[model samples]
Target chain A: GSYTTSSQQPSKLLFRQLFEKESATYTYLLADASHPEKLALLVDPVDKTVDRDLALVKDLGLKLIYAINTHVHADHVTGTGLIKTKVPGVKSIISKASDAKADLVVEPGDKICFGDLFLEVRATPGHTLGCVTYVTGDGPSQPQPRMAFTGDALLIRGCGRTDFQGGSSQQLYKSVHSQIFTLPKDTLVYPAHDYKGFTVSTVGEEMLFNARLTKDEEAFKNIMANLNLSYPKMMDVAVPANMVCGLQEVESKPC
Target chain B: GSYTTSSQQPSKLLFRQLFEKESATYTYLLADASHPEKLALLVDPVDKTVDRDLALVKDLGLKLIYAINTHVHADHVTGTGLIKTKVPGVKSIISKASDAKADLVVEPGDKICFGDLFLEVRATPGHTLGCVTYVTGDGPSQPQPRMAFTGDALLIRGCGRTDFQGGSSQQLYKSVHSQIFTLPKDTLVYPAHDYKGFTVSTVGEEMLFNARLTKDEEAFKNIMANLNLSYPKMMDVAVPANMVCGLQEVESKPC
Candidate 1:
């Protein structure tokens, strides 16, 4: 709730918060407006909304460089593979730990550069084994980063479930503390999913207001262990589909 | 807005209106509850909602018989192929005129029978080459068929545009007048898509109040021609996927 966007925001940096209602997923689009290539990258592109995303890219005269995923999602398939077919030469990037085929295998500290800006990856696996947070500097000319795409490891006032898909409460708690909470207190946090209509949050706000994760490490682990959660409805189809970068399992295999 | 569900509805037929919010598609589940097989049929099952639909079928203790599409959709993939994989023995049904592969090819005047009720097919191709409306009697005890699934042919207040994909204003006008308007005055109409949140309408209501189709033949054609509607965002993906019973085109053939 403490999220803010300044009116004097850098003109060279373009950002948009795109939402897919079916899964309540937020896809972030960041581009360098001043770059001749109009280089753009999308984080967490959804399979169902690929056309809409592609249309927006064409409308902005931006050449998509990377279709990235924060993790192999359980709620919906990623659009990375499909985007590769639509936009020739566009690369699909994901964490090496995800064990999925992609154009680029990223690791912690890896910088995914596009145009004048780059997203610095931070390993924050808790929602899933390959979950990562992407941090980027304020603008092309700014050296200090002020925004973090926290995926599901950290949400507005809560965090992702640590019960399935290689999730660990202790690790999630530690990851949030070391990788996310340690960021600049005012840095903006854009999460992958938000069911309650929250757009963005801040490290300072989440550290103090995130009810589920603000407790001591032991208490946080206990909270996660005792929390009874329902499996997402799309898990069966989404996981397998996402494992192949959004291609249906049957389609990916030969007869 | 005029839609109504009565508690005293006939006990022999089980009916549920399943909605996929992504495409604003309404899938109708109808079953003859008193039959020993409990033969259930779905009209316009969406691809992404297959799990949800399958859950409903299992919970209802009904044996799914057919996954019927009103036409080859251009907004979202159909669940016919996926549903067949999940619910073994379920047949994919569509109009033979659609030129799409399915288990059973239907035609105008065909009767798609389940346990006790049957859906009479009426060719109403204006939105596409093989669009059809399915009309079923209220119940065994009722004398008149009072429900029609009008696909994209006859919407709540407007009909499908005659701008692309074998669409024709003249054919659409003729189909509505002869096949739809002449139905029982009280026949309830369930459209495939409704962006304004309307659930149902009556033949009597549409004839008098449907904004786009109530005019004379020439006026209706002009209305259809002047729609100037934007293409659906998912058309490219949906049409190709649907042509193969919702299988992704890339996955259907050899690498």
Candidate 2:
């Protein structure tokens, strides 16, 4: 199916999962290992932790190529805009359906490639209509099982609230069952955020243990109705700031 | 040379990194993938998170053979005893010199094995006199570079204080350079705890960037001396509770 040669492939893939405690967001840094260029990309970076992420990138000698967000977050403004401002050629990417401003807009099935490694995008809405999951390739030849970057659609033993942001409990259930649960049992699940300290989970584990997802749709809807979660504190400012690429607000400040 | 045949080898090694937010401690779960027996081990679990960690181990269908502590911690009590209370035949491990009671005592060059994977214990005693670093094997045939579980001896861009519990800056410097730093440059470093959001680093990165360990012996001693760090709030309770293995304190309390 592919024509790439062995020498052209990287010996390893550099992966790091970083946390932003205030919003409990998880940001991901991915790059190809042993390549001279050290091309890298980030997913779901938060505005508050740009400095720390940038320093890490510099320390690893990785070249920034893209800053991608799975959705426009209500919890925190994204750092893509700040990253672009700091790194001359970096591009910001978001799902076109989100109606957010980004340098490049992607749709489902699009391949986000960094050297030989690529994340296949899958549209998994209901947490937010534009939500997408980035999945790695899987096969006997792949170094590791597929990893699902399930923004807010999935969490460890939990799922994102479908009470706001065009959220529909029914739609979320459908999306997860169709797009994510079908992955290989061992596929690692990395979410966009976590309130609990869990860092990762597997598709098999979640299929068996995910609280709301395991219930029937009606029960899940009932649970969602009664969740009684207060409106997110950052939603008012973060949503607007995030829609325009998360940089203008930071730049708008005199500092 | 390994006499083990291909049929006996596991398809993959199951690894999970769990976090405890209160203390910023990271607990590790490791097992051989696809083995019917599913024997597993945990490293550096915290007292506050025994329930959460136990639930996960059960969810993963892993048999807990050992609950190993890299050292008796001052900031928080270890969870080995509570784990033992819940799971039968689980051994609690610590360094023999730590002066804390554990079911099994380890010395340098000790091999802690589960299935085909094993961690080579190397005594690295600078943060505390009894501190040890557990390193995985590395070579052309290994799946990944060695992983050093450097319990407080090293953290990301920092090292533990040498202000108490047989602390010595010069001794720490000697232990690190002679034991940990001598490992392969690419060996991944997994510390017992981290204040910052970083979860892992490499021996090479820490060698160049570790704030305390990178300094010359004299300079390192000066930094450790002037830290002015406050006495650990939980030291009085945690240290004593940890000495007899962490479960007795919990048993002493009632509903």
Candidate 3:
């Protein structure tokens, strides 16, 4: 559902926030008068909760123009393909550097425009080989992008695992220190998953408290090596299911 | 491998303790003059850790007479089958009420004798179906049990999960109050797994500090239901592998 603001400035940008607390996944739907009927994007949508998202889109009277996956997830199943099936005209986008299959892959420094909204893709491969973060809006004249959707690359108090496929601790260190950490400190950081109780944090908070980022390379590697983390319980089932984007055609069965 | 104690007592009972701090798995090897070659029993043996236990047996010049499982574990694989395979003449025993496959399944009130050492089995199925606690004594003359191996049924400061298969909070409450709590307050409680720093506790301490048992039933159920426990990462791999007793015929692979 849409809520109206009382500001008479005629420059208010409307966006709705939805969160799947179990997975710590945050999906935002941004819309305005210029993109009323056919302009919307979904970032990191979860598989089982697609119905709630679809309801929101229908209630807002907006067409899903694109479904974006920040990266292949290790925690939960992705719903990119499922949205495409339900919303026929929507395009599924990912980093061109990713090894996973996608319909429309864009490279770094690429720009995607839907109505008045402009998204600039930045390739930030630290947590995984093809991880990317989208920078929405251009300069101060445009609405300041006060948010970033970091899919596993960065978390509130911790970082992503670097022992899995396409993972490199060094690359992640660089990605955080150079790209994400350098962002405006006030930028609200929305991570893909949060194991701890934290839901969100500012860039300043992460730069100060993130355990891995604060350690030197040698210490970080030793800490990562000593971590007795078990593999994700759904890896065997979720990976294959996500490869096809939420098992679009497969019959659902009891877990 | 063997240490000598110069105690001038008529009854000679020397016991060696092995501790796996990660899983809180404690194994005991007891030796007496009457059953030198035929009175060895292993408690709470973990998968692939059999080599260490076997080396201790060989060094002490004692034959392994029995291998026992305290309960079907949810966190780690059991090594009872591996011990049985390595020592062909040894008999593997578990509580007859267990759903898991076993050769010699004994019930509650059953007594197992090994020369001068005797163990009385008590059916304790709160943690899981077929869980049993073995009370070991030097002989009938030893009025008190020197040790009790409680597999998941009781922990140092906590209790086992009742959300998994065959687990019941009500059953657990009954098991702890009637069977375990009723035991001598000073009886040593050896648990299967303890992630919290403590290694062991007495029945009296548990009755006083066990967060679950001390609370009312409704409060206990709420605590259990809200426990933010993730599915064990190795559950899928460990369950099937443990079904055949630590992959007897299958080649071992690094976990």
Q: Native-contact fraction for each model? A: 0.00, 0.27, 0.00
DockQ for candidate 1: 0.01
Superposed model 2: Cα runs more than 4 Å off: A1-11, A138-143, A249-255, B1-11, B138-143, B249-255
Tell me the deviation in Å of residue B25 in model 3. 38
Model 1 TM-score relative to the real fold: 0.50
Stretches of candidate 3 exceeding 4 Å from the true structure? A1-12, A247-255, B1-255
Best by TM-score: 2
Query: Would you list the C-alpha lDDT of every candidate in the order shown?
Result: 0.78, 0.81, 0.65
The per-model DockQ list reads 0.01, 0.32, 0.01
Q: What lDDT score goes with residue A246 in model 1?
A: 68
Enumerate clash totals for all models, in the order shown.
0, 1, 0
Per-residue lDDT tens digits of candidate 2, residues B1-255? 010001111224566778888888999887755456677889998988989988987877788899998888999988888898889999888888887788788999999887766788999887888999988755432335557899988888998899998988888889889998998777778888877688788888888888888899999999989999999999998888787677664443320
User: Which residue pairs collide in model 1, if any?
Assistant: none
Tens digits of per-residue lDDT for model 1, B1-255 = 111111122335556666677787888888776678788899999987888778666655689999899999999999988887787889889898998878788999999888877888999988898999999854644323267999999997788877877989899988888999998776778889876535566787688778877899899888877878898899998888787787554353411
Instruction: For candidate 2, write residues A1-255 as lDDT tens digits.
Output: 010000111235677889998898999998765456778899999988999999988888888899999998999989988888898999888998888888888999998877667788999998998899998765543335567899999988898988888888888889999999998776778999888788888888888899889998899888878999999999999998788778664453321
On residues B86-196, what C-alpha lDDT tens digit does candidate 3 reach at each position?
888776677767655566778888876665766789888766777888876544443233457787888766888887757887888788788888876656677776553
